[model samples]
Target: MADGGKVVCVTGASGYIASWIVKLLLQRGYTVRATVRDPLDAKKTEHLLALEGAKERLKLFKADLMDEGSFEQAIQGCEAVFHTASPVTFTVTDYQVELIDPAVKGTLNVLGTCTKVSSVKRVVMTSSMAAVLFPVTPLGPDYLVDESCFSDPNVCSDKKLWYVVSKTLAEDEAWRFAKENGIDLVVINPGLVLGPLLQPSLNFSVSLIADLIKDKNDTVNKNSRLVDVRDVALAHIKAYETPSANGRYIIEGPIVTINDIEKIVHEFFPELNLVDKNEASEIIPVIYKLSVEKAKSLGIEFTPTEATLRDTILSLKEKCLV
Candidate 1:
């Protein structure tokens, strides 16, 4: 078990989100205990090791969400824990194994271990906007989502309904556990995360942005709000250090149609000349809009809308994805 002052632990530390969380923490002079399911998976976590802080300030450890004692070492004596590890698959055949079990169980294990660690003061859980609107309520034409809305997976009628259901249940269980344990917790619910990835190998969500740039996504979602990965990481950093911060925070960037993504990038990378015919302009359907007031209240400033789009496009280009 680790015992240190102001040490932080990040689960799934090599993942797209958690990797950035670790990067932010290490840059701030915090010792980190980064957990992966298998520390020996060199191919999976090699890029993480090359990050600026991984060698001296970061310690790689093995933890399994399915195992009770696995997360204990990572959480031991840490001041903050970021629980970002979970299964998110758009094409999982079994909801029980793919979404429900890992998300719910991983949260339980991490927070359960949080209870045992004497030094832990806060837990920043990486929840999604899906927890707010899915299966449960169909977002209205003029709906602007805030902390008050919550998705009910049981009510959703879709092939990928399990992803929404698992996130909602897991987040609900987090609050239930927090209330029962008297531990302070904060949740970050961002709408459709985008931006630079620390370990981008074409994961399910990251690949969505890649697909959009290729002019491949035809099924329209009108109101697509993309939050920069840097902004989401910054939000977590702000929440983790704020002793009095509690409850849920939405990390939304801006409201734009799907075409905005193509247009913004195409202007910079004119080689592709990405554009849509004006005929199908009304095809994009709005899903949900998340409020960023609470997160802004915590000193999390967002990038200007123009810069947000430009930076996202540049980051995607740096990866040679477009």
Candidate 2:
């Protein structure tokens, strides 16, 4: 589909990844209808207003993920819809209240609006790799994971992996809704999303990195599969623009351990406290490798893992968040 002059709706427009999606869309000359939890929250939305062409092309709407029909007005008459709104917390007192309900209900709400708006040809969903792979177990050597894998729902509990369960269920609901209602759908499953954030505040995932820099997380056994926020954003645009794009796409970098991150940090910014040094030196085995072959088929060349880490650290430096 042609991007120029088309109207698109981005739910959770003020979020880390969504904000970058909005910026890229506006840069390409598309009219953006952006949804925020509170439209009047200047601190949350001021950066969006300052974007290029936002004065003429950006429209802000107040919407809530838990409330049905809240996104109807913003989604009407749009050519494409990006469903990026969902809870991202790893710690929660109530899984039902804090994570699961919002993710599942919010996904259904957005898809319901898409069904009503006949003009919407495609709905690009921002699903997490947590849906495809979480509560990650040790696998046989060289065992690789692709889009076909789904995080086992049985393992989820209020005390552990609630976020994983929420995303897994929400994405399943999206696919079911699309199949039953005949809505064109595309899903993006990204791992450990990181990069320079357009929004003023730090991202939840990015905050974990900040925490790591400050010697926060003591767990040293696991490794994270990282992806640049800009690459993720571009993948969203490609998913919408490419008519042949369908099903799920995994976006990620090489998985690295906490000690690896420590080495990178010390290599880049020795001025900061050495956090990873105190952790275990044994590198986590490559239990499961994520394949990005489908994303590559769509002409998405991911940024190098070293560059991704470097840029993320540099951005954190610029924000004084490190």
Candidate 3:
């Protein structure tokens, strides 16, 4: 038990990252108000309730991202708000309706409720590296991507990268709203988050690794910046607790390729059949060097890639998902 009196709210409490945030907050002796679509849904709420300190410290509230004023009950009397609920999908029939609207509007709805509540002191939002990596100008290996970088909305739109565009626009809108409304907001732009899943269902990031392991035809093409899901959760808490923490923090570990992932999985689990390196497609030469000095300053020592991948595989196996 760290401190017993502090109370905070976490949106999307059933999510891969948010569930860890809720678990950690409870372990630290903070009273947690976790929001989910349906509190009665065992699949979503059961795992959260089973956390070590959940019985004494966790409370679930029903909230929807699309519904305005839905978060008022959850955020009321909370000291800090962790806004982690946003639509995440790579495929969408209507980008505006499916991805962009839910992400951008849901963010504003949460922020709007925060503005009404007097106890809300700070808001920690989970923005993705997708928001920071896709800049308009092309860069070479010499260029380093940092928190200062912004993904070009026009480019994302043109490429039909709706997920990237959604994250970028939502984060941009968050900064603008925080500035205008005087809300103390801190955003964490995390890389491809991979680690053990607290939630029962497989998330998008972990599925990428699972796909590589299970699908023999999967090819190693583009490079990816990976970060442990636990590290991302810890970063959010640190950002809120540290008074000096401000602006966006790029939370990422080493940049790796699919072949790198396949090798690691083979090293850890020899029985598992993974993608063949020889049959892999032409690897994309492009790479993004992320500057995480700001996030480290908040006392976040990133988890090693091997440990992250190992834990991820173990978790998936435990859940019988791999």
Best by lDDT: 3
Residue 69 in candidate 1, Cα distance off native in Å: 1.5
- Candidate 1 lDDT, tens digit per residue, 1-322? 2224358999998887888888878778789999998889886688788888678888889998888879998888788999999887867777788789899988998999999898998999999987887634468767878887878766743535788778888999999999999889999998777667666476666576567677676543455666777788878888987767889998886666666666776788688755563555555655555577889988987866667677666776787766
Model 1: which residue pairs collide? 132-151, 135-156, 222-285
Error of 1 at 246 (Å): 0.8
Expressed as tens digits, the lDDT of each residue in 34-128 for candidate 2 is 99999999988999999998999999999999999999999999999999999898778998899999999999999998999999999999999
Candidate 3 structure quality by residue, lDDT tens digits, 1-322:
4465599999999999999999888878889999999999999999999999888889999999899999999999999999999988988889899999989999999999999999999999999989987898866677799989999999999988899999999999998888999999999999889999998899888888777777733423466778999999999999999999999999988767767777788886798765456544346665656689999999999899989999999998899887
lDDT of 3 at 245: 98
RMSD of 3: 1.6
Instruction: Tell me the spans in candidate 2 whose CA falls farther than 4 Å from its real position.
Output: 1-3, 134-138, 219-221, 276-279
TM-scores for the candidates:
0.90, 0.94, 0.96
For every candidate, C-alpha RMSD to the true structure in Å: 3.1, 2.1, 1.6
User: Which pairs of residues collide in candidate 2?
Assistant: none
What would the TM-score be for candidate 2 when compared with the true structure? 0.94
What ranking of all candidate models by TM-score puts the best one first? 3, 2, 1
- Model 3: residues with Cα > 4 Å off, grouped in runs: 216-220, 279-286
